[model samples]
Each structure stands twice: as structure tokens, then as C-alpha cells.
Target: MGKLVDGIWQQAGYDTDNNEGRFVRWDSSFRDSVETDPDARYPAEPGRYRLYVSLACPWAHRTLIVRALKGLEEAIPVSIVDPYMGEQGWSFSDGRDCIPDPLFGARHLHELYVRAKPDYSGRVTVPVLWDRRHGSIVNNESADLLRMLNRAFDAYANRDLHDLYPAERREQIDAVNARVYDQVNNGVYKAGFASTQAAYDEAVGELFCALDWLETHLKGRDWLVGEQLSEADIRLFTTLIRFDAVYHGHFKCNLRRIKDYARLEAYLERLYAIPQIGSTVNFRHIKQHYYSSHRQINPSGIVPAGPILPFL
Candidate 1:
């Protein structure tokens, strides 16, 4: 809900008014790549990278999924912030399931952004790929980080970890990604943060339309892209896994629950059954962060406990 302007932490810095009640997400400013070149900035190393993520955030969740699928947990460490994001934004507290910032010992996530670039100006969002060697962020964009984690560090990753983004199927994967990103991935936010009835209607319509397409598309297919698992499935899985839990209620995206879609429900279960994939899901953090952090939406900050998880 806020951003950094010229390295200063400005609370509630985002303004969606210009879009005529549409909630437009700001672009992530920290964009660098981690390559496996022998002579490149932020070269791939076993312990040279770390991630700052919130289990609640779907964008951040993307990286976590890849890290697990590729077996990069031991190679690249991660620090989780508190779920209850108040005026101070994401902070590293000694709360349950929250891993404190051990690298910089910063109290908040913003400190790491500033540490990377003193005059940084943008939203402080995660799954930040921090380069311990450069003392800066290699990349903050979740989509980019997914690819990086899939291949860039394959040397350090487990030998059996299959490539989620294979070179041959990239075109198809990118196509699925484009549709999912605009419609379902970010459409939930657009609907939840809409300021007017028209904007809300537009967003909710788009969200459901996308879901409808996915429901049909996944009828006979187990994965989003080709015969095997790909980046597209990882991208859509984060949103689907959180749909009924948070998006359906908190975000007012209640046109239909993921359970209502026969194939989608089965597909969700299949993905969750993957080894280590379930560990990335923290409903407590997901529910609290959405219901509490967005005070404008849920003023009382009361997190719902019902609609039992069917993730397994």
C-alpha cells in the first residue's frame, strides 16, 4: 500500500486515483539478473544469494515454490517478515514462523532496499533475490526470479530438479504466463482495490473470465504448459492455492470458489502433493496479511478461520 520515494519510506505512498478507481500496481525497480557466467555480475554461487519473502504474498510465493522444486533451500537462504503489516510495513519480528533478518540485522524490509540502493524509489515488494556478494538485489521481479531459480543455479541445485522453463517450450510458457498474469494473477488485486462500482465490476468480470478459461483449459491437462511441469503451472498455482482461502472472501472475488471447478480442484491437489511444495503455504500469514494489512478493506483486521484448507 506504500512505497519508497528517493530512498525515503513514505507510508501509503501509492495513489490509484489516477486510474479512475482502478488499482494499478507499480513496477518493481530493482531489476538485475543472476547468471551462471564465470565473469558476470552476481554470478551463481552456492551461498551467495538470499531471499526476503512473505509467505502471504503470492508474488513472493512464486520464488519459494521454485526454490523448493529445485532444491535450493540450502543454497539460498530466506527471511520471512511478520504477517501483520501495520503502518511500519513489513518488519522482521520474533513472531511465529517469522525468520528475523540475520544478514543486515535491519528491523524492517525497507532497510534492505535502501542498503541495496541508497536513492531507491519504488515499491518495497518481495521475493527479493539479494546478492550477498554485491550487497544488492539481483532481481525483485517474481517472474524473472522464477526463471533464475529454475536454471541459473542448476549447478548448485539438485541434479534431478527438472527445468520448469525449458528452452523449447518457452514460447508456449510465455503465452500462458501473459494471460495468467493479467487476468488471474493480478486481477484479484485489481478487483479488491477498486475504488468505484464500475472498476470493481470490470475487474471481477475479468477475474472470473480468466478463471473460466482456465477451468476449461485444464479439463484434460494436468499442467498449464506442456506434458511436464513448467513455469506456467508455478505461476498459476500460487493464485489458485490462495483463491478460496483469501481471494474469495477478503478480495471479494466470490464469483466461484476454486473447489467449484472440478478439474481445477483436482489440479490444485496434484500440485500440492508435490514434494516440499506444501511447506511454502502458510495460511495464517496469508489470511492475516490481507485482512489486516489492508485496513482500508478490513478495518477490524479480523482474519477468518473457516473454509478449511483442502490443499492436500
Candidate 2:
């Protein structure tokens, strides 16, 4: 993976050496929001915003789940990038499941970032909320986009049936999100991208510990918070769905598979059974991206064929 320096694409990978082999994720640069008020800078207008995403990215996957769950497919269109991230980073291709950028017809994702801010300097990551009206990026942070998409388009959403982030359960959901984000959602990356044995062991230990805690917490519950699915569940779902299929083997996070945790496995199946939720998962893209993109971990650049998901 690479980043843009002063709007110039640079082939630079993570600097785990300086941080004692820890895989530290860079902060998302764009943090604007889409509000419901018409006068707002980024009002939630149907057809005014476009989402740039990668089906392979878990962060980008979260936004896709929320968009589907809220039934905003037509309201907010999406353009998916090629799964196999080469040296040029995420790009548009005639490859299966790829969608070219309709507005600028840009070849690479960073081109759009350059269009948004000529001298923008950071890792050009997804899911990017592009404001078609302003011809600029609204936001690139998935956490922000999750909440933004959750309610911003309620007026236009086909299934504004339920609030994923309800007022009453916000506290609980945020708390759950914090732990899961640290030890679970991003824990797998910490373990996988770690350069040192100590870093990997520490990350793996926390990951399994968090998984064990989740198993206990979900003993007689259907969701992570409240009685219904919340942002907490959605955030964790993206990571859990990829655990056995990718993380276990590719990332060397093989302490135990999600299938081994009876409750988590069942919980995963239950969530995956939801049509909107299940459709967001693309195992082929997920596998190919991790195995091929992170060439440092898997120098052979070969995607695995086994460890079939039972839920599928």
C-alpha cells in the first residue's frame, strides 16, 4: 500500500520498523459530514453524493452495509475499485465487480483525491464520500460515513425502517464499539502486519481474548447492543466475516477460527443470513486483496483456495 505526498503518488509502505513492528493505521484525512438540513454544507441530497469504495476493504464494507441496510442504493450510488491493489494502488478496471468513476473517469483513486485537494497529502483510503455538487470529497473516514449514512439519507432511503444508532442505546453501542475497534476490528491487522514476533504475539493475544469475551457477552443475546443490530454489530461483522477466510491463514491470526467459537459462528451466520448484510460480503475480492496487496507478508502473491466459509 502507498500514499500521496503533496498530491504526488509515492510508493511507500507502512513504517513498522520505527514503531517496534506495530502496524499503525493512518488517520483518515477527510472528515466532512452530510447533514439532513438543506442549507448545510453537505446536505443529504439524493444523487448529489457518490461513494468510492473497495469491496475488499472492511472499512469500506461497513459503509456498503449501512447503505444497503438503510436502502439507499439508488439515493447514493457507489463506484467499486478493483480488488487487486497493485503498486499504483486502487484503480478502476474492466475486471469483474469493478465500477469505473463516472464523474471524472479517473484511472486511479488518488486522482480523485488530487481533484478534491491538489496538494492533499495522506493515504488515499476508502470509503470516500464524494460530493458531486462541489466536485470534492466529503469524507473518507468509514466511522464517520457509517453514522452519516445511517441517518443522513433517511428522507430518501427506501428502508428507513429502523435506526441502527438509536438514542437510547448510543452509550452502550459506543462502549462496545471502542473495545471491538481496538482489540477486534483492527486487532487482526495489528497481528497480520506486525513485523516483529513480539508485536504479532501481543496482537494475537488481545485478538483472541477479545473474541473470547465476545463469545461470553453474546451467550443469550442476538445483537451486540440493545435488542436490535447496532453500529457495533455492523462494525464487528465486517471483520468477523473475514476472520476465518482471510485473517486466519494469510495474516497468521490462526489461534482459532470464528467457526471454533460456537456462539460467534452462529452469530455470524445469523447476521450473514440478513440479505442486505450478506450481500456486502465478497469473499473472492476479500481473499485476493489481502493475499496479493500485502506483498510483504505473502511474497509469492498467491491467494489461498481453502478454508471455505461454512456460513456460505
Instruction: Provide TM-scores for the models.
Output: 0.97, 0.99
State residue 233's C-alpha deviation in candidate 2, in Å.
0.6
lDDT for each residue of candidate 2 in 17-111, tens digit (9 for 90 to 100)? 99999999889999999999999999999999999999999999999999999999999999999998988899988788889998988999999
Q: Please give, for residues 1-312, the per-residue lDDT of candidate 1 as tens digits.
A: 567789999877346688898989878777788888969987889888889999999999999998988888899999999998867678899999999999979998889999999999888888888888778888889988988898988888874777788889999999989989998999998999889889999999999999999989997898988899888998999999999998999889998999999999999999898867778898889888998888898988888877886664
Local distance difference test, each candidate: 0.88, 0.93
Report RMSD (Å) for each prediction in the order shown. 1.1, 0.7
Find the candidate with the highest TM-score and give its number.
2
Residue 234 displacement (Å), model 1: 0.5
Model 2 misplaced regions, further than 4 Å: none
Reference-based TM-score, model 2: 0.99
Worst 10 residues of 1 by lDDT: 10-19
